[model samples]
Target: MASTTIQRSAARTEVEGAARTERPRGAIAFGLTRIAIGWLFLWAFLDKAFALGFATGRAEDGSIDFFAKGQAWLNGGSPTEGVLRYATKGPLAGFFQSLAGAAWVDWVYMLSMLLIGGALVLGVATRLAAVGGAIWMALFYLATSIWPEYNPVVDEHIVYILVLVGLAQIGAGRYLGLQERWERSALVRRFPVLR
Candidate 1:
């Protein structure tokens, strides 16, 4: 039993030593970056839902209107219609255009943005969120920004996907997020992939 006691003490010492050590470099910055990207998605969901005069809340004359009720999703606005129908270009234009203004499409896109943004911000289900966000960005990339004058390929969408993949692979949620607590949950413990 002495050997067992000694081993437990050694493990405790190691854990204590790790706790006293400095945080890994860029840990906080990584978490902040995750939150920022998450907010980007969250803000899009908010702006589209409320027509807060940024991208969604615009008058017919192209003027910004803070209270453009008709432009908001909550007020009958179609979030996917404008881009899917008019803005989609390139070879996939027809495919994307075919999906324009569909209520289900709008619902899916809006809900995805909310889920991804909320997950990233809260640092819960980050891996799933990252994957979902990356796929969503890919769809947007294919829908509109497939062809840019600046380059043959590569754009903000691609960059965002890469960042998301990185965040997921690194478990960025654990850094400043509730992921540690989430990981200990019964559901997450049973379904490790959800972590």
Candidate 2:
């Protein structure tokens, strides 16, 4: 009887080993996708930081005012005629518009871009970055949504946000990011669902 039990266990192990040997389904593809997504955020941050000149359109200022750019677009050659004015025209618009040309605006925009883009590329606080990225993309979508032909209905930025959200939901960082360390920490382990 003991011999028979041992034989059965060995058979089970063999079967499991065989299953493990089977080709994995799209693992490489998924990893590549994640890396590509990270690259996107990295590129965006770099592009805006060095070349695009943030929201202020003041590359000389060396700061990024993300919202300021939108404002400029709206007041200037923006396709979204009243959208920016309508949303920002209230007391809030007046307040931010005041800061539009200010140096502080550049600092804020640069910092925000760095934080959001850095965290996303590194996969640290992935869920947080994902949510933030989504909001950012949504705003862009709003700006572009006003014009169908020039801006179009579909944008890659939106897709990247969605992918970020999905990866965060699955804790994709565990496989290849700081999220693995994050997840194992007391903060995450205690909650077990924080991420």
Candidate 3:
């Protein structure tokens, strides 16, 4: 009877441990940072996609309109056309410009923003999101200013990359996000990177 009791206790303990995710004291900080970075991507996507006019979809009079049909992606405005064609200044200008206004490229960029932002914000698939977001930011850095005025080898993109790596390394998503439950999912078990 004692042996059976011990076995039951052990099993119960194991299940409890598995069900309870531990959050470090610093979890809040990392989770907040993740949300902030995610918002950068998400906000950009919203502004561009809907032309909210903080940066895009401005009228000829420089007035702002919510969901204005003039320059929104929905209205056929190209999210990247102005930047790639007119604002690209680095040695890769031609390359960047070549991708300007292409419907397919716009779709890809928009989708990247939505997916990466959503993943990071929701605290699921953060590793994959970090990888994809880092690549996207790096490309943006390369296109706009290969030789940044203030620094030769560092910029916001690089900082973001470092933070992303740190987040992945520490499992930032597990702290306050849905990461623990997400990892227990069978699909994530099969693909650890999705964690």
User: In model 3, which residue pairs have backbone atoms overlapping below 3 Å?
Assistant: none
Q: Lowest summed-lDDT stretch of 10 residues in model 2? A: 73-82
In lDDT terms, how accurate is model 3?
A: 0.85
Sort order, TM-score high to low: 1, 3, 2
Deviation in angstroms for 136 in model 1? 0.7
Ranked candidates (lDDT, high to low): 1, 3, 2
> Cα miss at 168, model 2 (Å)?
1.9
lDDT of 3 by residue, 3-120 (tens): 9999999999988886655655677999999889888888889999899988886777988876776568887788888888987877899999999889899999999999999888
Clashes of each: 0, 3, 0
TM for every model, in the order presented, reads 0.85, 0.53, 0.83
Error of 3 at 108 (Å): 0.8
- What digit string (tens of lDDT, one per residue) describes model 1 on residues 1-195? 999999999999999888744356788987998999999999989999989888799787888876466689998889889889888988999999999988999999999999999999999999999999999999989889988647788899999999999999888898788888998999998999888
Candidate 2 positional error at 158, Å = 3.2
Candidate 3 at residue 106, lDDT? 90
- Candidate 1, 88: how far from true, in Å? 0.8
TM-score of 3: 0.83
Kindly report which residue stretches of model 2 are placed more than 4 angstroms away from their true locations once superposed. 1-24, 52-105, 150-152, 185-195
CA lDDT, candidate 3, residue 143:
91
Most accurate candidate by lDDT: 1
The segments of candidate 1 whose C-alpha lies over 4 angstroms from its true place after superposition are 1-22, 60-64
